[model samples]
Target: MIPLSRNSAVFGLNIDPIGHHNGAWRHPLTQVSRAYDISYSLELSRMADAAGLDMVFIADGLSVNRYAPDSVVLGFEPLTLLSAVAVNTRNVGLVCTVSSTFTEPYNLARMMSSLDRISHGRAAWNVVTTANPNAALNFGPETLPDHDSRYERAAEFLDVATALWTGWQADAVVADKDRGMYFDPDRVAVTGHHGQFFTVEGPLNAPRSPQGKPVIVQAGASATGRDFAARYADIVYMVSQDLEDAKAYYQDIKRRARDHGRAESDILVIMSVRVLVEQHDNAAQERAAELAELVSAEATLKRVSSFIGVDLTRYALDDVLPPLPEADDIQGYRTQLALVRRLVQSGQVRTLRELATRLNGGQGVLSFTGDGRSVCDNLQLWFEEKAADGFMILPQQTQRDAENFVKFSLPVIRSKPFGRQRPEGATFRSRLFG
Candidate 1:
């Protein structure tokens, strides 16, 4: 058992306004800020930081106008937004997603390194593979790469990026004006990388960052993703619907981390959970219903079709699965199909629409409900069971929901000891591991 600390850590939120569920963006209180609205992002970032939370993370995509054009889309690139947030927040870590599949390791290295430096050690990178086929088209590809191939590229991409990050000695920059030297060239080594995915030559033009490299966070729940997280991730963001499954995944990843020669403490497993919080339980439940009602059945079906790579419109609401010999394109569809079968076997859901509702937000990602104390109690249960080291929170509808997390949940969390506190001015690594 991971011993409870003198104080439990406050959870951080990941705002996936559009990516989370169909109705999230349409919530009555949601601000329709342009996806890239820096001021809007900064407000949230500062709020989280002020709450004494660990970080604010943004999930990204290269493609525009996915799922439904009428709905909100990824407005600005995540790294760029992080840079804007860097100017506003003092303490909260800023993590941004970038795909190893589409970006060159060298550019990724430089960008993340610079952001870390600019933020004075508060930047992190969430490495991902671009899984959507539409992303491939947007990036000028005819088809998406196979699942295994994407991981293979990511492995090499990480290797090259790390080499580039380590290429510069921390003492390389010595601004000795009297001696007329800006930096010692001798201490910098060019990272000449030759790989299947990318070729790069570098000493990262940027100097060593505060944390050496931005904390490498990875999020994928697939087998290849698990392997990647075990090997490279400093923080692993996971999506699991149940505590039992969450624990199994957590233990498996930590074990894998040990096999890869990393201490379990070096890896922080963060489950992505959404909470629907209100002043009262009934109010909360009503809010959830309002949010659920905003969901467009057509949009949900389109998203499901996109996710499963089948025309869900053709099937009746209660139709059973057809054979999948023809739907060879969608990587996760196979898993979804299997899950549907199991749900049928278990009698949990009876229709495709019902399955879509269940799977929408809380399906893949863990979700919670009720007042603040209850939510914190549930979180403590997960932490006590070693189901997760912590969580990456996603609020269901409004920014007020996120604000409620900070206002109500955080105080209780910070008051109950669950993990060690870092010394003043501690690095993230120190804060996490010390």
Candidate 2:
């Protein structure tokens, strides 16, 4: 297990160009034209790095989401985009999503190792077994594997990738001119990995990176997903609706890690939060209301339908969601589907319209809209209560909202006992698990 500083919290920014809210692109302050441009992301990375944030995470999918227009799609491939951001920033970690189901283990190892070298050892991989069934079509498959099956493949994929990453020992390179030796060839070993999903005979072409191996991140909340994460992930990005849920998830994952003979502290659990920060509470509330007003019910329904693998449009806006299929049968995000199901069964969420609106921001992540102080207070409470190790900030409006949080809330957060400031010359692994 990686050792972490006691009482210190880790922070990351989830950079979705269009913003986390469904209506953010339509907001008056948002520059829709720059959503696809690399400069925009570059600027955001600079801002985040300046704030001493730990990392900048880019979410990806194999195909554009069906509910939204192509304009709102993730404009850059995650690795290619983060590689660009890596040279521009000095301290912040660059994490990008890559699907294990569609990608070859050897190729992923090489790409991540290359990025780690390029960034001087600040690369992280968010491992995902693509949840979007549409992703299957892109990869020439008629259907996505079942929930357990995908996790099974992901587990094997990680095993092979890790083996490839460890192909060359830390001291493999000799670089001796007098002896005419570039490397100690005996120190490098081939990874003869043969598994149910992959066959990789690799002594990765790329040498060992500065960090030895880039950090591994996973985002899965179902039973199988949690087991997979406990066994392999260095960090877990999660979605929790409230404090209780967050606490439960935090304890469950940690305990599971222990069961796997791993230290709980080795895996950092960061929850996703959509922040709407303004100078005044009233303004923040007003901005949230305005954004909500802009949400497209039709677009939202289609989006939710795609997420749960159900045609939600068939039900009336006022109707509560009916019972869902078992997770074993669902091809989409079964954990998320179970979460929404609980909300419906508990009467906390009543109608389809309400669910659509709630999910519009951060896709069911906890949302906090208030002045900077209030935002700080909320984060502190979560950290203190053991509900989360930290949060992945997803701004409601990319420019104004994100900038406001960094300019205002970040200072307050850093001033607190649990808050952290990045150390000089800190590598991503050190900053994450200090």
The TM-score values for the models, in the order shown, are 0.90, 0.95
RMSD of 2: 2.4
Q: For model 2, how does the per-residue alpha-carbon lDDT over 1-434 read when each residue is reduced to its tens digit?
A: 12334887889997776788888888898888777899999999988988888899998888865545633766899999999999999999999899999989989999999999999989999999988887899889898888788889888988888888888999999999999999888999889877798888889987899888889889777888888998899998888776787898899999999999999889989888889999889999999989888876766777666677778889888887767776556778876776777677667788888888767644576788999999999999998999888889999888778888997798888887777675744568977766
Model 1, residue pairs in steric clash: 5-417, 5-418, 5-419, 6-417, 7-416, 7-417, 7-418, 8-416, 191-202
- Per-residue CA lDDT of candidate 1, range 151-262, in tens? 8999999899999999889999999999999999999988888778788888788889988888889865666678789999989987665567679889999999999999
- Each prediction's Cα lDDT score? 0.73, 0.84
Off by over 4 Å in 2: 1-5, 65-71, 360-362
Model 2 gets an lDDT of 0.84
